[model samples]
Target: MQTVDKALKLLEFFRTDQPEIGLSDLARLAGYDKAATRRFLVALMGHAFIEQNPASRKYRLGAAFLHFAQVREATLPLATVVTPLLDALSAETGETAHASHYSAGALIAIGIRESSRANRVHLDPSEILPLHATASGLAFLAFGPAAPLEAAVDQGLRAYTAHTITDAAALRGAVAEVRRAGYAISNQGFEDEVVGIAMPFFDSSGTATGAIAVATPASRMSDELRVLILANLHKAALAATAGIGGIPAEAFVRAHGERRAA
Candidate 1:
């Protein structure tokens, strides 16, 4: 188990920005000695999970992931199902709309639709959102399983901006508010001058497995705009949840239904 954990942790070190790492850097990043890291790397290479560039002597992810991703998409087609809803949400609100999937204590951006406006918020599909510092994360914490909250607290809330909630107690309060409102609003928590409004989307088990969010520039936000965004966001969330063959919790459905009716 420890070996498997170490191997998985090593893979996570490779990201969109830092796509390659030297042997020494990999050892340092993984907190393992050079010999152990090399052994792990050799094992991974054998499975075509990691490949080394001969010229730079740096390691990068191999083609296995591409095949795996293709297989997953062919089977699940989650992004295909969610993209249209995101497009509609972005069109309605004139903001950047996105969807995230909760997996292994992380919220990963999966699909996005940027507004046609020139000054729209930008998002990277590879970004792993901080659970305490984004509307998508907050909505997941409020409506999803309890393990993610505990994991976030244990990992320590690293403040990305001055508005980020760093205190565990404060984070709990924020999550409570989300639960009550059936959605979450993040104001410059993850990035300055950006606001995110999010609604949780559930899985077949009636547990929130992901979220749909609209990100807009703070300069453009207003009470009327917020209301308009929420109204469209609820419809998008419901369609996305059902499109993915998921079941929203009764409370979630009730809250949005009442809000829309009112």
Candidate 2:
């Protein structure tokens, strides 16, 4: 188990911008003995999970990684499932709409649709939403499993901006509010200029799979605009949830019902 953990740690060293690492860098990053890192790399190489570059003596994630990712993607196909929702949401709200997937306790942007407007919020596929600082992360925390939320709090919350939630207790309180409201809102939490709203969608088993969000410039945020965005966002969330054969969080459904009744 320890060996497996170390080998997995090496994989984390590769990222979108830095896809390759040398043996010395890997050893330093792993914080393990150089020889141990070498052994792990050798084992990963044997399994084709990591490949070496003959020119630079650097290593990169190999074909097996892509194969496994393709297998998982083929089964779930999150991008294919969510892109249309993003497009519709962007059109309806006239704002930048994006969708993220929850994986290994992180919310990763899977798809995004930029509004036709020249000045719109921009999101890249590689962006990871901070659990304490983004609407998508807050929605997932509110509607998804409890373990990941607790683990994230345990790891500590780093403030990204003045509006970011830094206290663990405050973050819990914020998430509780999201549960009560049926959706999550982040006002300049992750970025000073952006205000975002998000709703979580569940998988076939009724587990929260991910979240979809619309982000607008703070200057454009008003009571009327917020209402408009949420209304369209709710419509998109429901359609996306149903299209994927997934479920909406019960609190969301119940709150929606109460709103209708009122």
Candidate 3:
């Protein structure tokens, strides 16, 4: 299990901005010795999870990810159901809307619909949202499984901006607020200029599986806009939850009261 974990951990470093990485740099980032990192890389290469760049001597993600992605998309199809919701939300609020999934104890962006407005926030699919720093992650922390919350706390909170909640006690309070309000809000918590709102959703088994969010420029936030976003999000969240054969968290349903499909 440890070997498998270490091997998968290597893949986490590959992101939208840094897709390829040299062996030594990957070792440093992963905190594994060069030899162990190399061994893990070699194993992953055998399965086509990572591939070496013959010219650059760096490594990038391999074709195996494509195969796995295809299987997941075909089977789960969560993104297909959520994309329209994001599009509508983005259009309604004139803000960037995104959907994310909580998988393997981490929050990963799964889809996005960018507002055509000039000052839109952009989010890339597959980007890992920090559990302590993003509204989507905070929503999950508030309403999702306790294990993920505990795991995130154990990992230590790293502040990304001055507004980020780095203390465990403060984070708990923030999550409690989310529970009371049936959604989560982050003001410059992850990105210095962004204000975001999100609500957690569940999967077919009635387990919390993901979240949806709308982000706007911090300067654009206002009480009226906040109310609009929260109202729209409640509708979209319920629709998404139903489409996925899921249900909203009991706490959220209780806080906001259940709305039937119109």
Candidate 4:
């Protein structure tokens, strides 16, 4: 614990107003020896917690911070605001419905409801999925910050099941489809038994930072039903975005117009 604490303190130096810090200065600011600071930095680099400039020999915070910050947000009190939406979606669709939001670099399930149908695919509210692997992923990917979307494709798609698309080119095509359709649909990408459809939550910047989806058992829902479910989910996601001050009428119109052209 003490080692971790000291290491974290060393990181604080980078957060200082200074743009970057050399090992010696960082050590001095963090109250640690140069050798200790070096050790911490090496470990952090291994996990991509810090980035070093090759020529300058200075360190700065890395993308890992963004991922961590996002995870922290996911654990906060989002249930109260999301539960009603989850319930309504599930009740109307008769499918397992969920609300998830983007945090740092992930899609976290903040709320969920199981379908009343006799047999249905169900996802636990506590479960979180990758921002790279579901209908949820496609929805956000179609509208998230451009960098993460490219990074996700660069990281390579992990095959969750036989139906999951592993080719970057193919995935890009799917994103284009989602952009055109104003929603995303996945046929057993994460789970072979579940087909999910989702729509993005546009943020104040017009970036889709989060999404909501419904999962139905593949054996239970036909393609036409999935299409209907996606339409409903798109509406709910838009409502959620509007409630969160993420979508202005002008922004929505622009996004919709772009989709039509795409």
TM per candidate comes to 0.94, 0.87, 0.92, 0.66
Sorted on lDDT, best first, the list reads: 1, 3, 2, 4
Best by lDDT: 1
Task: Specify the poorest-scoring 10-residue window by lDDT in model 3.
Answer: 253-262
| Model 2 ranges with Cα > 4 A deviation | 260-262
Give me the displacement of residue 132 in model 3, in angstroms: 2.3
lDDT (CA) per prediction: 0.91, 0.87, 0.88, 0.77
Q: Best candidate, TM-score-wise?
A: 1
Go through the candidates in order and give the C-alpha RMSD of each one to the true structure: 1.6, 2.4, 2.6, 11.5
Model 1 Cα lDDT, one tens digit per residue, 153-189:
9899999999999999999999988887889999999
Candidate 2: C-alpha lDDT? 0.87
lDDT of 4 by residue, 1-262 (tens): 9988888777645533575888999888888888988999998888888889989989988789788767755664345555787888888788988878886666877677888887988775445576556998888888777776788778878888998888888988998787767777888889988888888877678888778889898887786787568557756877787667677334445655675566
Measured on C-alpha atoms, candidate 3 has an lDDT of 0.88
Span of 10 residues, lowest total lDDT, candidate 1: 253-262
lDDT of 1: 0.91
Instruction: Rank all candidate structures by their TM-score, best first, as comma-separated numbers.
Output: 1, 3, 2, 4
lDDT of 2 at 206: 70
Predicted structure 4: lDDT = 0.77
